[model samples]
Structure formats: C-alpha cells, structure tokens
Target chain A: MLSLSSQFPILVAIAPLMTAPICALFRGKAAPWAITTIASAFAFYISLQLLLTVASSGPISYELGGWAPPWGIEYVVDLLSGFMLVLISGVSTGVLLFARESITKEVPTSQLGLFFAAYLLALTGMLGICITGDAFNVFVFLEIMSLSSYALIAMGERTDRRALTAAFQYLIIGTVGATFYLIGVGLIYMMTGTLNIADIAARFPEIEGTRPILAAVGFIVIGLAIKLALFPFHVWLPNGYTYAPSIITAFFAGTATKVSVYLLIRYIFTVFGVDYSFEGLELTDILLPLAVLGFLSMSAVAIYQSNLKRLLAYSSVAQIGYIILGLALANETGLTASIVHIFNHAIVKTGLFLSVGCMFFVVGSTYLKDLEGIGRRMPITTFGFVLGGLGLIGVPLTPGFISKWYLVVAALEKGSVIGYGIVALLMISSLLAVIYIWRVVEVAYFREMPEGTVKEEAPISLLVPTWLFILGSFYFGIETSFNVGIAKAAAAFLMGGA
Target chain B: MSFGFFNYWVFIILLMIGLYTVMSRSNLVKKMIGLSLFQISVFLFYISMGKVSGGTAPIVVDGPLDTAAPIYSNPLPHVLILTAIVVGIATTALGLSLVVRIRESFGTIDEEEILEMKDGA
Candidate 1:
C-alpha cells in the first residue's frame, strides 16, 4: 500500500466527499453532526499537512487510478492551491463546530441529517475545486457546490418563506453562469484539444492571438465575474445571504465566492498568463473601473440597510471589490494584497457572521433595532461582533489593515495620477465601512436595553467556535508571518517568478 | 453564415431565446423551463464540437488489426455533457421543489407578488 503522506492530496478532498452520503444515511440526531465535524477535521488536517509538504518540498501531483495527466484526472497542490485548501477546510471545521448548536435551533430535527449532508457535499465541492487541475473538472465541481448550496439555502424556508425565492433566484442565475463557463471551456478545448490546465497553458503561446482563444478568455472571465459577484452581476448575493440559515450564511460567506476568486486567479495568471490577460486584452482597464464602482457604490448601499445581515452581505460584495482592485493593479504587492485579503476577509467575514448567529441564537433577531443594548445582555457575543467590526473598518493590528496597507503601497508604487485616485477611492470606501459598522455599535452599545431584558449570553457551544475565528483573525493580524508569508509565496508563484 | 456553420447559428439562437425568456418571465415554472432550455443549448454546443467530418462511432471493431485504423469522433465532450446533464436535472428538480414550497407558503409564485409581500412585511 502507498504511504499515507503520499495520498494526502486526494485524501484532503475524499474525506468530505465520501462522508457526505454516510451523513445522509444516519437518522440519529447527533450522528450526522459528529460525522460532518470529524470528516471536516480530517480534511483540515490533511490540507495542513499538504500545505506544509508543498511549502517544504515542492508541488505535489497525484494521479487518479494511476492514469497519467493530460489524459486522466490529476490533483495538484502548489503554494496557492495548498493555502486555499487549508483556508477552506479550516473555516469549514471551525464553522461545523459551531453548527451543532445553531442548526439545532434553526433547522427542523427531521432535516438535520440531510442538512449536514448538503454541508458536507458543499465542502467536498470546494475542496475538489481547489485541488483539481483539469478545466472540465472545475465546471463539474462548480455545479456540485452550486446545487448543494441551493438546497442548503432553501432549507432556510423553515425560518422565513422568502428563502425559497432567494434560492430559486440564485438557481437561475448560477446555472446560467456555470453554463457560460462550460461554453468557454469547450471553446478552449476545441482549439487546444486538451482539458489539462497546464497543458493548455503550454499550448497557449502558439495560439495566443487566435479569435477562439480571445473569445474563450472573454467568456471565461465574464462567467467567473458573475460567480464572483463582481458589481453589476452581484444581484443574487445579498438576498441569498440574508435569508439563508445564519450558520450556512457564515459558511458560504467564508468559502464560496473566495473559491470563485481562486478560479479567476488560476485562469488569468496560470492558464492565460499575464501578458495575454492584462497587456494583450487590456483587462486591467475593464476590471479597474468595475472595481472602483463596485466598492464605492456597494459601500454606499450598505449604509442604508436596516437588517445587520443584509448590511454585512453588501459589505462582502464591497470587499470583493478590493480584491479585484488588487488584481487589476497587476504588480507583486497588488497580487499579494489580493491573495492575503482572500484569507483575511474570509476569516473576518465568517467571524462576523458567526457572531451574528450568536446574537440571533439568544435574541432571535438581527435587525439593528432588535439588537439594541445587546452589548450589555450578551457581552461576550457583542464584544466579538465589535472586534470583527473593527477588522472590517481596517483598524490597525487587524487582518483588514494588513491587506489595505498592501493595497495602498501597491497603488503608490504605480507613481501615477490614476494610482493616487485609486488610493482616494479606497479611503472613501473604508470610511463608508466605518459608517455601517458604527450603526450596529450604536444600537448594540449605546442604546438602552428594552424593559424586562435580562443578561443572557449565547451558549458556550456556539461562543467558543465563534471566538476561535474572532481571536484567530486577531492572532493572524499580529503575527502576519503565516498568512502573509504564504500569501507572498503564492503571489510570486502566480506571477511566474517562483 | 454558410450551411457548414448551421449548428453554431442554431446554438446561438436557442441560447438567446432561453436567456430572454428567463429574463422576461415572472412565473416560476416558466422561468425554470427557460433555465432548462438554456442548459440544453449548452449541451448541444458541447455535443456539436465532438463531431468529426468523416468519423465513425468511437467504439473499436473486431477485425481492424492489420488494416488502417478507423477514424473516430472525439468522445470526451460527450462524457463531460453526461455529467452536466445530471447536474442540470438536479438543479431543475430542486428549483421546482423550491417553487412548490414558495406557492405553499406565500400563496403565489409570481415574482412581483412575492416582492410586494416582502416589502409590506
């Protein structure tokens, strides 16, 4: 038999993929949750090992069924993919820890088994996307993630019927997006006659300026933009996040769009290469304007939301704008900022949503008015929310500040007037972030508690995992070596300098 | 366009019709029909690409060891679409089920009515 370490790459994906069906089969109350948590923990451990192994040795390529690459499926774990695997699985494990208590309250007891089953399927899909090296496999995994999420989102109908509408709307938009991506992949395959990502990149130089290749790039970028929720195509995000079960919202907030961002990075930087994407197609000119408008307008829109979840949902979109802006900058620092923010934002946003879940657990509402004086009643949960809010505002010693700092430095390195303008735009958006987060603080801390309100905290089961993420973000912010070091290495690898 | 590119024209036209229906319709079931149509158009596009000008089925014959090998059409796209088709069915089923639940809860499946109720709430 092969050594266990030799199989870490595939095991990272298979643990969750294989466990999902078992989760569905178990009818016991706690069996499914136990299975999900254990599977996620296993996947997280393997991913961490994979990341360390890649960082120390080199990229690991595992062939499925002993079939060679460019023919059979292959799984590759490099610095970027390894980092993403750890991020996705790590967040999944943390969120699953909190899920037992939160899901118990929100989802019906009969549906709990199937609920965790879908969660595991979504986790498997995301991990598969990070590890797969084939273009067609990406589309397959993308569908897996999307279909499972639709069911998970619709499960929220038990709380509010609007979730059904939200899930349906997302289903329509998401299917169109995935189909567009498949068309793009088909066009590329027609020209290159290979579905392997590395093989396509190798053959691209010869067919660099061909019409089909250009169209493929156009279709692929647009499709991923929709999936990434880049500004104009982000209509499906806010409602979907707002109406989903709180824990599901937190889970998807952390992993789903970030995976799409990863695919975009892989396609642009690895498959198409920098010269073709930015200089040849002038993609920066398009992405820069959209990024600017996205952050500015979305932040402005966020400030008007009365529901705290809806407000943060809009902020997530605005944060995606910052990541895209970094990609548009197209420098080492810019890409580093983008890559690091993917980690930083996922941690911060997921923590924020979990804190909201904690509040909802106790008080049964997340509206600004309903959260009044919650700081006094639920001190631990409220404090966690405020700290996560500080991260959102890019305060010093928060992961958000580290990324925004890199962004400003990248803009300054441009040494052009447009660069200065982008710096100003970034500041204005952060200021908008302050306004929205402050609205929550004002309600939670300053407003008087309603009559007969008692001091009751969310149960420790939920609070512990919530603080695990909240404090974890703070730890990464101060240490900076783990997240930043990996991000820099990933940026270098993407820029083809490693 | 030449008759040689007829499949391309059909694919583009079907795609446009499906997309327009999805955008314009308010009834949830009709919207789902449109989505299935949209996905089916893509399946057609993929299947069309696998065809070779004068090739036979990809299966191997018994008496071809000494003679020239038979030309076979590409089979990869067909296999990929089979997976996509399964995904499409799942999406359609889930979407229809959600629509059923919406009708049960809200007493209507019209997009405008649902939005109006949400705003009033």
Candidate 2:
C-alpha cells in the first residue's frame, strides 16, 4: 500500500481534475453537487495528511513521473507550503459546501454544472501553483487560475454589467502580468541553463549584477505586484470583488491573492537568496515607501465607501500593505511577521467576507443602508461580524494583534523609530475600522427598524462556515505557538539558512 | 557594434512602438496588435542572443555521446523560446476574446469612449 504522505500532492490535484469532467457529465443537481463535494472532501483530507507529514518530517520533495530535479519537474513541500496548502484546500472545501445553495440561488440553473467545473478548475490551479517546484509550471498554473476566474466573474451577469467590465479589465492586466513574468523566467533560464527554483537560487549569487538578471527581478516583481494588487495596481480588485458572485468573492478574497503572496515570498526568499545587495535595490528604498503609502491611503479611502462590499475591497488592499510592510523590513523577524500575518489576515478576511456574504444572503443587498436595524433580527451574525471587526482592529485576543505586534517589534529591531510611527498608524487605522464597523453597528442596533423588515437569520449553511472562520481567528490567536514557531523557521529559511 | 547592432536597435524600436501603442492608443484591436508586437520583440531578442554565425543544426547524427565538439549556439534557449511563443499566442487569443466581450457589452471598441460611457452611466 502506498503511504499517504507520498501520494498526497498528486491526490490533492487529481481528485479535483477527475471530478471536474465527471461533474460536467452529470445532469442532475444532486449528483453534480455530490461529486464536487466528494472531490473537495478527498482533497481536504489529503491536505491534512500532508500537513501532518510535513510537521513530522521536514520539507517533502517528490520528483514527478520518477524524474529527478534540475531536469525533470519536482514538487517541494515545506512547512510554509504545507501551511498554505491546508489553508487553501480547507477553505476551498468549506466554500464548496457553501456554494451548493449559494450558486443555485445566484447563478442561472442552466449553468450550474459549468460553474462547478470552473470552481474545481480554479481550485486545482491554486493547488498546482502551490505544490510545483518549477518556474515555468508556475506560469502555466497562473493562467489556469486566471482563465477560470474570468469565467467565474463573468457569470454574475444579471445583477450588474460591471462584472463583465471587471472581468475584462482583470483579463488584460493579468495577461500582461503573466507575460512579464514569463519574460523574467526566460531571462533567468538563459542565464542559468536550468528552470528549477533550487538551481536558480544556487546560481543567483555568481551573476548577481548582470543587467539581464536585474531586469528579470524588475519584471517578476512588477508582474507579481500586479497580481497581488499592491496599492497602485489594486483598482481592478475593488470592482472585481464587489460585483462577482458572492461565493466567488469569499473564495478569491480569502485565497487568490494569498496564493500570489506565497509565490512572492517563495521567489524572493527561495529562488533569489535574501541577503544580496539586491535587497537594498528592491526593498528598503522602494517597496517600503509604497507599502506605507498603501497602508495609509487605502485605509483612509476604505472609510468613506457607501457600498459595504467596496469598502471591504479597499480594506483588503490596506491589509496587503501590512503584509508587504513586514516583508520590506528585510530581516528575519520582519519576514516572520509577514508570514504570520499571511495566515492571520487570511483568517480575518475570510471571516469578514463570509459574514458579509451572510448579510447579502439575508437582505439581498450589502449597502450600509440595507443593514440598518438588522442587529436585532440577526443577532448571531451581527455578533460574529462584531468579533471579526474587532479582530481586524487588532484587539489583544485576536490574531491580527499578534501579527501587528510582531511587525512593530521587527521594525524596532531594525533600529528604526519609525516603528512607533507605524504602530500608531496601525492603531489609528483600527480606529477608522471601528468607525466603519460602528456605522454598521449603530445602524443595525441603535436605529429604528425599517417597516416590513423580515426576521431571518442567515441560513445555517452560511452561518456555520462564517462562524468556523471567526472562531479560527480567535483560536489561532490564543494558541500562538504553531503560527509563530513555523513562521520564524520559514523566515529563517527565507533569510538563507536551513 | 556594427550592422548587427543596427538590427538590435531596430528590434528595440519595434518593441517601443508596440508598448507605446499598448499603453497610449485607444483602439482595442490596435492594443492587441501592440501586445503581439511587443512579444515578437522579445522573441527577436532571444533569437539574436542565440545566433552563432556559420552554425549548423546542433543535433548529433551519429550518437548521443559526441561530447568533444562544440559546433553550434545553445539549443536550450531556442527550446525555451518555443514554449514562450506558445504562451504568447494563448495570451493574444485570450486578450482578443476579452476585447470582443467588452465591445459586445459596451457597444464600443474604443477605450476612451468606453471609459466615457462608463463614467457617464
């Protein structure tokens, strides 16, 4: 019998791939849903097994089709990637379970099977990108995810024409970004004669200052920045998030950009060793200031949006700033802070958006006005939203607090008083978050109930997933050893140690 | 730097023309063509980098282990470029598809007009 550890990665991708065509072939609602759920369930189970294996052993590297690395493709599973795999697959399963009812309600009935197929394809692409060890493979999986996302976003046809426009704009930007990245990889290959990431890292130091390599760095960083929606490139994100079908919003908001951030970390730390003079070239001078600007400006902008979904979209950009700021510090503590925040912020954002999705399901709109007097009617969901909002604000018991504390500490460790400035800025931003959350709160609880308001909590289907994510934020907050310990190790690895 | 340099300089000019059209022009079809041209410039750059004057095909007709003779430019870059060209074609196709969708939805193919209509709405 094959041990679970060896087969886990292939199983994670193949389950979804095989079921995708099966889902398309089926005719009935129940059968397709069952097949999709089973596939996701199997993938989630394999991911958990893989996580346990990685936690026990160190990184697991497997050669595909029995070919060794530097020539054949490889799959490298380290603690950082295992962390991400569990998150993506686990959240994907939750979203698929939730999508059964959500898709039927929002998408047209005729396209239900097609929607499932696209969802599986997107999940497979994300997993493929996460597990692969080759650069060109990364490009292929990036296209897979992008193409499926465009289809999924365009499916939101009746509610708004803006979805089509958003999808189109994303397509253009995404193609350009991917092409830029391919050019970077090609340049690197021409220099190194190998496309394996480990080989590239081993060779990056010898040809450090060549014009071609610097240009490669520039191209790759810009391409990834666009995908990650770093502040200046984030305009496509707000409309895309706000207008896409509800389940798609929750999934992409939670996982898509997070995966790109993973790639960014991997490329920066693993493919290109961290301690080169290139650090000064990329991080301290340029990315630091942009990250700071992203944090402040996006938060200020998020405060004034009337639409709740748009408001949250801008907040996502601001949160990305926090992650990037941690990375820009270019130290072990700073890198750990960034990685820790990736997981913590993912939990927070997932809870926040899932709560919003619940609100959307009940009220049929996510305008702040629509939430007025909803507190009494939907007390549990309102309370959950309140908890997630406080987490976003970095309250002491919440996961966001841990990430923010580390980021501030990292900045201080770098001998910079600007650490204090960033801490204060973060607090003030939280206060702004409070203002918006309070706007929803006051409208929900303090204001008079609108006439003809119906008394319905969000369906248990939605509430269960939303609460699970909120509880995870708080749980991970209290049990800080796992996140902090692994983050430090991964950060060390990024800083060019074991 | 000689006539060879002039060929490279022309390639750079073509690249800039393509990028300028992509970023500055308002027509959707023109932008697609620009994207294609920009990609073609990169192809030219790779091909130029791999050129070995008076070089024949590097494939060994005798056997796999003719290790002593170096007769040609590297075939690896050419192989890499082939994959890149295929990816480029896919990108162009997808861009055109999106442009078609945009035109159908907005009833216009001009970027400025589309923006104006969006803002007006």
Candidate 3:
C-alpha cells in the first residue's frame, strides 16, 4: 500500500469530496452531521500534517496520476498553501461542530443532508483551489466553490426570502468574476502555450511587456478584485453574508473571500511575479488608493448598520481592504502582514459570527434592538464577541494588533510621505473599526435586558466552538511563532521567487 | 485586418452584448441568457485559439503506413472548453432555478420590482 503521507496533498481535498455524496445519501439527521464533521476533521488533520511537513522538509509537489508537471495536473504545497489549507480546514471543522445544533434551527430536517453535502462540496472546492498548481484548475475549483456557496446561501430562504435574491445577485456577480478570470487565463494560455502556473511563470521572461499580457493582467486583477470584494465590487457581499444561514455566514465569513485572496496572491506573486505586477504594470498605484479608500469607506458604512450580521458583513469588506493594503505596500513585511491577517481575521471574524449565531439561537434575531443587554443573558457568548471586537479594533494582545503592527512597520520602511500617509489611514481605519464594534458592545452591555426575558444562554454546542475560535485567536496573538513565522517565511519565499 | 482575426472581433461584440444585457436588463431570465451568451462567447474564443490553419480534427486513423503524420488541431482547448461548457450549463441551471424560486416568493423576477418589494417590506 502507498504510504498515507505520500498522498497528503490529494487527501486534504479528497477527504471531503469523497464524503459529500455519502453525506447527502444519508437522509437521517445525525448521520449527515456526523459524516461531515468527521470528513472535515480528517481534512483538517491532513492539512496540519501537510503544513508541518512542508515547513520542515520544504515544498512538496505531487504529480497527479503519476504524470510529471507541465503535462499533467500537479498539486504543490508550499508554506503559503499549507498555511491556508490548515486555516481553511481547521475553521471548517470548527464551524461544523456548531453546525449540528445551529443548522437544525434554521434549515428543515429534510434538507439537513443536502445542506451538509453542499458544505462538503464547498470545502472540497476551497481545498482544491489551494492545492491545485494549474491556472484552469483554479477556475474550475472556483466555480465549484462559488456554485456550492450560492446554493448554501439560498438555503437560508426558510429563514428569510431575501436569501433568494441575495444568492441570485451573488451568482451573477460571481459568475462574471469567474468568467473574467477565465478570459485572463485563456489569454495567458494563448500566449504561453501552457496551463501550468510554474510553466507560465518560466515563459514570462521571454514575452514580457506584450500587449496581450498587459490586457491579461488587467482582466485578472479586476476579476480577483471583484472576488476579493475590495470596496467598489463589494455590492453583493453584505447582503449575501447578512441573509445566509447563521452557520453558513460564520463558515463563509472565515473561508470564502480569503480563498479568493489566496488566488489573487498566487497570481500576483507566483504566476506574474512582483516586478511585472507592481513595477511594470504599476498595480500598486491603483491598489494602494483603492485599498485606502475601501477600508475607510466600508468601515464608515459599517458604523451605521443596525442589523448586527449586516454590520459584521460590512466590517468584513473593510478588513479585506486591510489585506489588500498590505499587498499594495509591495514589501516582504507588508506581504507577511497580509498573509498573517488572513489567518487572524478569519479566526476572529468566524468567532464573532459564531457568537452572533449563538445570540440568534437564543434571541432568534441579530438586530441591535434584539441584542439589547445580551451580555447579561448570554454573558459567555457576548464576552466572546467583545474580545473579537477588540481584536478587530487592533487592540494590543490581539491578532489584529499583530497584523496592523507589521503593516505599519512595512509602511515606515518606505520612509516617504505617502507611506506615512498610509500609516495614518490605517490608524483612522482602526478607529472606525472600534466605532462599529463598539456599537454592538454598547447595545449588548449598557442597555438593560428586556423585561420578563430570562437569562438563557445558547446551547453548549454552539458556545464551545465560538469560544474555541475566540481563545484560539488570542493564543495565536501571544504565540506569534506559528502564524507570524509561517507568514514571514511565505513572504520571503515569494520575494525570492520573484 | 485579415479574416484570421474575424473570430476575435465576433468575440468582442458578443462579449459586449452579453455584458450589457446582464447589466441593463432587470428580468432574471434574460440575465441568465446573457450569462450564457457571455460564457458561449468565451467558449468560441477558446475553440478559435485551438484552430490550426489547414489542419484536420485531432484523430489518428488505423492506416499507419509510410505517409507523414497529418497536421491536427490542438485538442487541449477543446477539452478545456468542454469542461467550461459543463460549468456554464450548471451555472445557467442554478441561475434559472433561483429565478423560479424568486418568482414563487416575490411574485416577480424583475429586479426593480423585487427591490421595491424589499424596500416596502
């Protein structure tokens, strides 16, 4: 028999993919949840192992069907992909733990199997995207992820009819985004005569500065920007996140757009190289201003949202701006900040959304008025939200602080007026985050509990997963070696490769 | 311009039409049709990229005699487009089904009407 370690790359994706249909076939209530959780746990374990292996032994390239690269599809697990795999699978497994109890409340019993099925398929798609080494394969896996998410979001129709419209809107926007990406890839393939990412990168030196390549870069950047929800193209994100089922919101809040960010980073740093993207094409000129505007504007918008879910959704778009801002910095430290924030933000946001899910479980609503004095009723869950909010505000002793610290240092490395200006923008954005997060804090703690409402907490199943993420973010914050070290190494690798 | 560039011109025109329809039209069904058209335009673009002038389909006959191998078109793009076509069909089906559900709940598939209802609600 082939050694299990030898197949870790494919196993990370196949574990969920193979189980999704089985989960769907089992129409029972508990079985589908059990199967999904087990599959996600298996994938998470493999991803952790793969990350450790890659960190120790260096990047591993697995040729599918025993065929070599540039001819057959390959799966490459370097430090970045490994770190993302762990983040995606770990968050998925954590979210699945809460899904059993939370999903039952929102989704009908008859649909639970199908819901988990879609969840696994989405997981498969995400893992596939992270693992694949081919450009076209990324698009296929992207559609898989997008289609499954569209269906999963629509499943929220039982809770709110707007979910239908929201999913429909996302479908249109997301498909257009994916198609744009396809057009870019096709143009690149036409020029380079290869689909493999490494092969394309190798061919770029000979065909540099060509018009078709320039057009391809524009198409790819715009497509990924839409997927990344970097301010202007974020029209579909808030509503989709707000109306999706609580568990889905929590799960996707952690994974979906982050995967798109991963793809964008791969294209920018790995496939196209930094010089071509930043210096030749001057992508930084465009991304820097947009990133600054995105965070400032989206954070301001978040401050006025009365619906807590919608508020957090807007906050998510703002946070994506922070990640993009790091990319725009075009320094190793800045890239490290972006990579680390992807992990940090995913954990903290998932935790905050899970806390909201918990409140929804008890209060049956996520509006600020419904959450009044929630701190007194569900203190553990509300406390989790407060800590997560502090993280968003970049308070010391939080993961957000680490990301912002690195971002500031990276900006100062420029030692120019523009850099200092960006530093100021970052600070202002953090303050805006504080304002929006404090809105929830005020309503939860300062306001009195509605009369005759008893002090009932969300069930233990939900609270445990919520606190796990909350506490995990703090643990990562204090023990920066895991997140920061991997991020720095990945950044150095990308810089060296370029 | 040579006729060799004709396919790309068709691609640009179809792409613009498809994108404009998806953006301008409020009917969800029409939007799906537009999406299909957009996807089909890309498929045509890919197929055109694979075309080898004066070459035949990429198939090998049993007659393996002393004759030189015949020129054949690049089959990879065709295979890639097949997968994209499958994805396109799936997207269209999903989009149409969502429109049906929207019609069922909101009583109309017009984007403006749905938004008006949402606002009223």
lDDT of each: 0.92, 0.80, 0.93
Give the Å error, residue A312, model 3: 0.5
Error of 1 at A320 (Å): 0.3
DockQ of the candidate models in sequence:
0.69, 0.37, 0.64
Better of 1 and 3 by lDDT: 3
Candidate 2 docking classification: acceptable
What is the overall TM-score of model 2 with all chains considered together? Answer: 0.93
Instruction: Tell me the TM-score that candidate 1 gets on chain A alone.
Output: 0.99
Off by over 4 Å in 1: B64-66, B119-121
**Clash count, one per candidate:** 0, 0, 0
lDDT of 3 at B20: 94
Supply candidate 1's per-residue lDDT for A129: 94
List the lowest-lDDT window of 10 residues for candidate 2 chain A.
Answer: A275-284
Docking class of 3: medium
Q: Give the range where candidate 3 chain A is weakest over 10 consecutive residues by summed lDDT.
A: A20-29
